[model samples]
Target chain A: DVKVTQSLRYLVKRTGEKVFLECVQDMDHENMFWYRQDPGLGLRLIYFSYDVKMKEKGDIPEGYSVSREKKERFSLILESASTNQTSMYLCASRSGGSYGYTFGSGTRLTVV
Target chain B: SQQGEEDPQALSIQEGENATMNCSYKTSINNLQWYRQNSGRGLVHLILIRSNEREKHSGRLRVTLDTSKKSSSLLITASRAADTASYFCATWANSGYALNFGKGTSLLVTP
Candidate 1:
């Protein structure tokens, strides 16, 4: 079975603080993604990495960035956290050209 | 910019009854996938149907795809209380590695 693990299940940060969410996958998948899920918006992509050091912006990438220094780890960074950034953040990974995906338990971020 | 939209945002059914949900996408897709998320948990991949295929099934779940209408349907037979969850439809676009997800349909199966 494939396992995707997130660094934190819940986090709280003050406004203007910096936050980091880490994700690791045991399957060595080539694609990693970060998404913020809201009540009515569904899972909107924030950023994705196809390979080490390669990143692309998704539909809602503002105030967020990603790092993929290694094949098994992907990190999402919030340069300056704001209250509006509070959300359920999910990390997902999939093998190259595969239809199935494995997702982390998700981090519920609270930016106060 | 959303790729898919699920119909009947929420549904409630008793145990042993069948639950059906529909999803419609806006653009051409390489494949469509269904995922289930329990309350406060990560999503679990349920099934996938390619654009060329019309229907697919696994165990008690059935999925149908209509490329011409750009829509798909998922049916869960003999649903139980444990089947309560939010079901989402995700689409893999022809060009990207990421899957675009719909808002999801929340299913409540009561005993």
Candidate 2:
């Protein structure tokens, strides 16, 4: 079975603190994504990377940035966490011919 | 922007009963997928129906797609308590790499 591992299941950070969420996939998938799931808003993409050292901004990438230093690892960075940034962060990965993405367990971040 | 919208924000049914949820999308898609999410877990992919396929089934799950209406339905027959979860529908939008997920329908099965 394919697995996506998220480094943190739950996190609490003070407002203005820098936050880092990490995701890793073992399937050798070429594509990786970071999204923030919010109530009523669904999953809004923050960033995605199709290859190591390459990243693309998604719809709601204003408060976020991403790093794909290695093929299996993708990281999401919150410059300065704020109350509004509190939400469940999801990571997904997909291969070239896969039907859909394989998702990580998710990281629920709370900014206070 | 989210492309899919699933109806019935919440549904409750007894075990062994069947539960159906509908999803509607706004634009053309290469394929549509169904996912199930437990209380605090990430979504698990359930089924996928491509643009050229009308219906597909896996175990007790049946999915139907209608391109003309831009709608799809998921039916879980003989539902169990373990099947109680949030169901979401996703589709590929203008961006070929990412998926646009719906708000989701929360289903509860009582034993």
Q: What share of the true interface contacts does each candidate keep?
A: 0.86, 0.76
Give lDDT for model 2. 0.94
TM-score for every candidate vs. truth?
0.98, 0.98
Displacement of residue B49 (Cα, Å) in model 2 is: 0.5
Q: Identify the runs in model 1 with alpha carbons over 4 angstroms from their true place.
A: none
Runs with alpha carbons beyond 4 Å of true place in candidate 2: none
Give one digit per residue, the lDDT tens place, for model 2 in A1-112.
7899997999999999999999999999999999899888888989999899999889899989899999999999999999999999999999978868899999999998
Note the clash tally of each candidate.
0, 0
RMSD of 2: 0.8
| lDDT (Cα, tens digit) per residue for candidate 2, span B23-107 | 9999988899999999888999999999999999999999999999999999999999999999999998686888989999999
Q: Name every residue pair that clashes in candidate 2.
A: none
Candidate 1 matches the true fold with a TM-score of 0.98
Per-residue C-alpha lDDT of model 1 across residues B27-93, encoded as one tens digit per residue? 8887899999999888999999998899999999999999999999999999999999999999975
The per-model lDDT (C-alpha) reads 0.93, 0.94
Weakest 10 consecutive residues, lDDT, candidate 2 chain B?
B92-101
